[model samples]
Structure formats: structure tokens, C-alpha cells
Target: MSFSTQVKNELCRAAMHRPCCIRAEAYGALLHATIFSHREIRLNTENAEIARRLQLLLRRAFSVDCAPRQAGSKIQLVLEHAEQLGHIFDALGYDLKNHVTYHINRNVLEEDCCIAAFLRGVFLMAGTVAGPDKKSHLELKTARHSLAGEETSLLLDLHLSPKMTRRGSTYVLYFKDGASIEDFLTSIGAPRAAMELMEAKVEKTLRNTINRQVNCETANMVKAADASARQVAAIQRVLRTHGEAFFPERLRETVRLRLAYPTDSLAELAARFDPPISKPGLSHRLKKITELSAAEEE
Candidate 1:
């Protein structure tokens, strides 16, 4: 299953011990649902689990029954009766007839647990998280601008910094930082999903570190091989122009070592000296040989 779906499914199993928390969660779900107004209360979802959870939440919170009906690939829970809709609005402390502006009932979410439950319900209805393998992102979308603003404030109250943007007619509240997303997931009762995200992040960092190390090593090997090949060619030219017998003892010894260990690194060749020399000393001798060969060619 997708990461978003996995998180939602886990959240579905979250326990609501208090009646207040249950009502808060249900209120969040209804507010963000496809249609939540006085005339009609409807929820449409492709996830059967969300549909089921909403049905149970409504019944538990307000004793309202909403049987989900399958519509093609989607499931919908609808309550059209005026009495049932009025009861839902009343239970949520929303006065549809008298209130000019719609706002979240902060009283129900006074406790931290209730706030978490409410956010969880919002996510189940209209939230999505990108797979950690791709990017770090978690977003909740709603058509109600006022609801989105209230959610941002609620998150801030919980010490979470969320960004808000408008997408067409919808307002989106999102968390971009990986740590923030993980914390949010954990707070909403998806600890397993949060752990998975962290694991994926660690695995990606490790893989990148290994690749950089391999590239550095490979580059060093190529540089060494190129230097060695040039050194060999220069030594061969010196020998051809001035026979080995004409060279001094030190130069002759260096020439012999180079001819014998064409593939050995400078350190390895240096170690083979009668009295081992440092890598820099060996390199200086090799440079002198190259200068002599160049002079002979000129």
C-alpha cells in the first residue's frame, strides 16, 4: 500500500477513550468532508476504511446512523434528514441558522489529546503524505478557507509550524521538514509510519555516503595510474637515449626499480630502495629522470 494509505489505516485503529475526543474527531472529519452543510451532510472517500471509521464515529458521537453506499470505486456516507443534520451541527456547537461566520469549536479541543484526535480525523478525510523514498511532505486540503486558517492556528498551539497555500479553490496546510512530518505522524497515532519514514531517510543518507566514497576512491586510482604510465614512458626514453651503464648509481637504481615494478604505487616502489626513501624523495628522483629525457629529445 502507499505510504499515505498506510498512515490512514493506522490512524483508523487509534483509540478514543473519551467522549469529548470522539466528538472532536468526528467534528473534524465532518468539517473537512466532501459536503458538510445544513441542507446535506455527506462524506465521499475511495478508502473503505475511512468510510467505516466515519460511520462508527458519527454513531458513537451523536448516535447518528449513516450507512455507506458504494458508488462505483468510491464509498459515500450521507445524512440528508433535517433533524439528523441539525443534531450533528448542534453537537458540534455550530449554529448554522444564526452564525454568520463558520469557525472551529475550540472548546472541544481544549485538551491535547482531543486536538490530536481532531487532527487525525482531518488527515483521514483529506490528508496525504509523500513516501520518504521520494520527498518529505505532509498536507491537508480543504475547501473551507476559515477551517484551514483554524487548523494552522491549532498546529501552532501544538508547537508545530505549518505552511499554508491556496490550490485552485482549496486551501492546503503542509509540513515540508522531515522531522516535523515525523512528529506530526507520531502525534496523530501513526508511530509505525513515522518510524518507517525515519528508516527510509537513514537508508538514503547511507547510500549517498557510500556512493561518494566509491567515487573518490575511483578517482584517486585513475590519477595514480595516469601518473605511473607517464613515469614509465619517461624512464624508457632516458634509457634509450643514454644507455643504463652511463647513468649514476642512484639514477640507475631508480630506473631498475621502475622497470621491475611498472604497476606498483610510488610508496611501494620507494619501499624497495636499498635504504627506503620517502614518497616525496622517490617522486623528486622520477622528476629528474623526466627532465633529462626531455633535454635529450630537444
Candidate 2:
């Protein structure tokens, strides 16, 4: 299943409690549902779990029953009856006779618990969050711009900032940063998904770090091997161009060590000396041998 669906399913398992919070959640769902009006109300979902949750919300919040009208995978809880619509509308503080405003009534979300529940409803109806494997993003899309603006304010009140944009007739409120997405998910009753997102981000960062470290180490080894090859070639030139007698005893010993251990690192070759020398001392001797070899070539 998609990450968004997984979160919704987890949220559906939450026990129905507190009549006010349940009403707030239903209000959010209704406001963002595919079609919510005095004439008809419809909550649409492809997931059977969410469809069931919506049906339960309508019943619990308004004492109204709405069975799923299923056509393939798309499930809809539809209410065309005025009495049922009135039941939901009255619970959300709306009058049956008036036009419904495309905005949130902040008064209905007085408590923090109600605010969270309301956000939960909004997400179930119109929201989607990218999975851990994808870029960090979470969005709520509704038909009206004014409702999006109002929801933006509601999110900000909870210390979470979301930007607003429009696509065709839909107004979108979205969080782009991982931190914001995590917080939003946790706030809307999906802590497991939030933690998974954070874990994925951490694993990705760690893999990148290990890759860079390995590349750097490989580059350094190549550099050291190239330097060793050049040193060995210069030593060979000194031996071939000028005989062993051409060097003093100390330099001759260094030449013998180089010829014997062409692949040994400077530190390893230095330790093989009759009386071991420091790596810097061995490097200085090699440099002198190269100079002598160049002099012979000239």
C-alpha cells in the first residue's frame, strides 16, 4: 500500500472518543470532501478502510448513517437527504438554511485535541504525503482557495508552517521540508509514518557519507601508489646508468632496499633499514638518489 494509505489505516484504528473532537474531525472531512453542500454531501475514497472510517464518522458525529456506494475501487459515502445533511451541518455549527462558507470556523477548534482531530479529518479526505523513498512532501488539496487559506492559518497556530498554491480549481496547502512534514504527520495522528520518514532520511545520509569516504581513501591510495612507482623508476635509472660502486655505502644500502622492495611503502621500507630510519629520513635519501641519477643523465 502507499504511505498515505498506510497512515490513514493506522488513524482509522484510533478509538472514537470525545463527541466534540469527533465532530471537529467530521467537520474537517466534510469541508474537504469531493462534494459538500446543502444539496448533497459526498466523501470519496479508493481505500475501503477510509470509506468505512468516513461512514463511522458521519454516524458518530451527527447520528446519521451513510453506507458506501461502491463502484470498483472507488468508494463514496453519499448523503442527498436534507435531514441527514442538516444533522452534520448543525453539529459543525452551520445552519441548514444558509450557504456554507469555504473557510474553517476556528471557534469549533477551541481545544488542541479538537484541532488535531480536525486536521486528521482533513488529511483523510484530501491529503497525501510522499513515502520515505520519495522526496519529503505532504499536501492537502481542496476545491476552494479560501478553505486552504484558513487551513494554513490553523496549521501555523500549531507551530507548523505550510505554503499555499493552486492547481486548476484545487487549492493546495503543502509542507516541503522534511522537518515540517514529520511534524505535520505526527500532529495528524501518524507518528509511525513520521518516524519511518526520519529513518529513511538518516539511512540515505549515512550511505552518502560512506560513499564519499571510500572514494577519498581510494584516491589517496592511487596517489601513494603513483608516487611509489616514480620513486622505483628513478632508482632503476640510477642503477642502470651508473653502477653500484658510483654510490657511497649509505646510498648503496638505500639502493639495495629499493631494488629488493619495489612495492613497499616508504614507512615499511624505512623499517627494513639495518638501523631503522624515520619515514622522512628514508624520503630524503630517495630524493638524493633521484638527484644523483639526474646528474648522471646530464
- Output the lDDT of residue 199, model 2: 99
Residue 264 lDDT in candidate 2: 84
Give all candidates' CA lDDT scores. 0.88, 0.87
Alpha-carbon RMSD of each model: 3.6, 3.1
lDDT by residue for model 1 over 93-200, one digit each (tens)?
A: 778686324588898788998898899999999999998787899999988899999999999878899999999998999999999999999998999999999999
Model 1 worst lDDT run, 10 consecutive residues: 93-102
Give me the candidate number with maximum lDDT: 1
Clashing pairs in 2: none
Clashes of each: 0, 0
What lDDT score goes with residue 224 in model 2?
75
The pairs that clash in candidate 1 are: none
TM-score of each: 0.84, 0.86
Model 1 TM-score on a 0 to 1 scale: 0.84
